[model samples]
Target: MPVDLVPTPGAGPRVTFTGLGGAELIIGLTGQSRQMSRWALGFILIAAAGTALARRGCGSKVIFIVVVLTVASLLALWLPATTDVANGAFMAGAALVPLYILIALVQRLWNSLFVRNM
Candidate 1:
């Protein structure tokens, strides 16, 4: 069957050209979403970090969470942006989950290495 071979445009803000194949070429991206999700995810990240930091006498877990979340939000901001509000926001938000888990691992390692009582 013939693949849906769409004309891939040159590099720009919108979709990027991947490559040509035997029959059809695939476009890496299609659009850009500069608004909408940006503010939403930004606010959520701020609130989450604020809340994590606000807790009094934060333990190692809290410190780890705050640092991890903040880093995740930062990385999310760096994620490749798509053409749709949903896509950009989704990619940004999705990028944070694994970051949080990594934070947990780092905290555990720190605890074992430094804080023996923890």
Candidate 2:
């Protein structure tokens, strides 16, 4: 490699660091590696499971809704970081998982509260 091609300490071109979601020291690029947050992983798993469950007996509309929401949430949480772009709005996707969970809880509560009386 040419001497000029070497990345100097603190004098190299600006490099955007993106989170690798648990991958560390990949291909000699330490800057790209990041520890995956447990919260993020949990949310991903929940969304995946929810999607799977939604497909079993739910209508097409319901399945579509679930898939879209889950995809959008994942994209929002990960796309910006993957692309090396700084967009705070993308982080909002992290909330969607909990939001969906909350919605389910509310629905269950409603059903339990009223359906049992019938």
Top TM-score hit:
1
Misplaced by over 4 Å in model 1 are 1-83
What ranges in model 2 sit over 4 Å off? 1-86, 116-118
**Colliding residue pairs in candidate 2:** none
Model 1: per-residue Cα lDDT over 58-105, one tens digit each = 364455455655565556567544223333333444554565556667
Q: Candidate 2 at 87: error in angstroms?
A: 3.0
Candidate 2 local distance difference test against the native: 0.49
Q: Write the per-residue lDDT of candidate 2 for residues 1-118, one digit (tens) a residue.
A: 2224467688957776678575344233324333234335544654565555542443543554456456656665676343222121223334444655666788889898888763
Best by lDDT: 1
Worst 10 residues of 1 by lDDT: 82-91
* Predictions in order: lDDT: 0.51, 0.49
